[model samples]
Target: MTDLSKRRLKTWIRLLGVTRGAENHLRDYLRRAHGTTLPRFDVMAALWRRRDGVTMSELSRLLLVSNGNATAVVDRLEADGLVRREAEDGDRRRIRVRLTPEGLEAFEIMALGHEAEVDAILSRLSETDLEALRDILSRAGRPE
Candidate 1:
């Protein structure tokens, strides 16, 4: 590879490693402390942010996950009585997933916990370094 190409590849690999470690640690924390998984929490967060509820397609898109994966998370949430899946009013073929009262309560707790955990993790870096890293990652999809 060219010098630039090798550097870019190395950057990608390092970013992936850091992200994987962060995700694994957060997932384990949630499972042990909240009895929840990352995917389920992500779904709940998406639904919580939207008052109108969300379709499975939308959830898949927002979560950057597969349709089957979103469906499985919804199934587990429904089984736990935290979320309810219903047919859309205008289109019976389309289903919407909404959090039940219990789900909202659980999500509130999880959200707060997650925010603190994320803050703690990011707090290791100085503000300027954090901003620089954010700037670099924000340009990830831009044309070089």
Candidate 2:
């Protein structure tokens, strides 16, 4: 490989490492502090974003996870009365998932902690450092 190619590969590896490390920390934080798995939290977050609710397939797509994985998490949430599944008027196969009042309350609490935890984790970076990182990520095709 050319010298430039080798440097690019190393940069990619470092970026992946940082991303995974941050994700791992979040996973652990969610599990230990909120008594929730990352998958469960993600499902709640997506639903929270779309208050009207989303079809099962849409939920899976939003989370970028397989239907089976999303189903497992949704099943658990349903059992806990955190989510309710409703069949679409004209389509039995398309079920909409919505957060219950209790679920909303729970997610709100978890979200507060999650936000604070993230802020703490990223607090290591100065404002300038954060701006630089965002610029680099934007240039690398990351959405704003």
| Top candidate, metric lDDT | 2
List runs of model 2 lying over 4 Å from the truth.
141-144
TM-score of each: 0.91, 0.92
Q: Give the TM-score of candidate 2.
A: 0.92
Query: Taking the tens digit of each residue's C-alpha lDDT, what string does model 2 give over 1-144?
Result: 999879978999998998898889999999999889989999999999999999989998999999999999999999999999998896878899999999999999999999998898799999999999999877984535
Q: Write the per-residue lDDT of candidate 1 for residues 1-144, one digit (tens) a residue.
A: 899989999988998998898899899989999998999999999999986899999999999999999999999999999999889987888999999999999999999999988888788899899899889888786775
RMSD of each: 1.5, 2.5
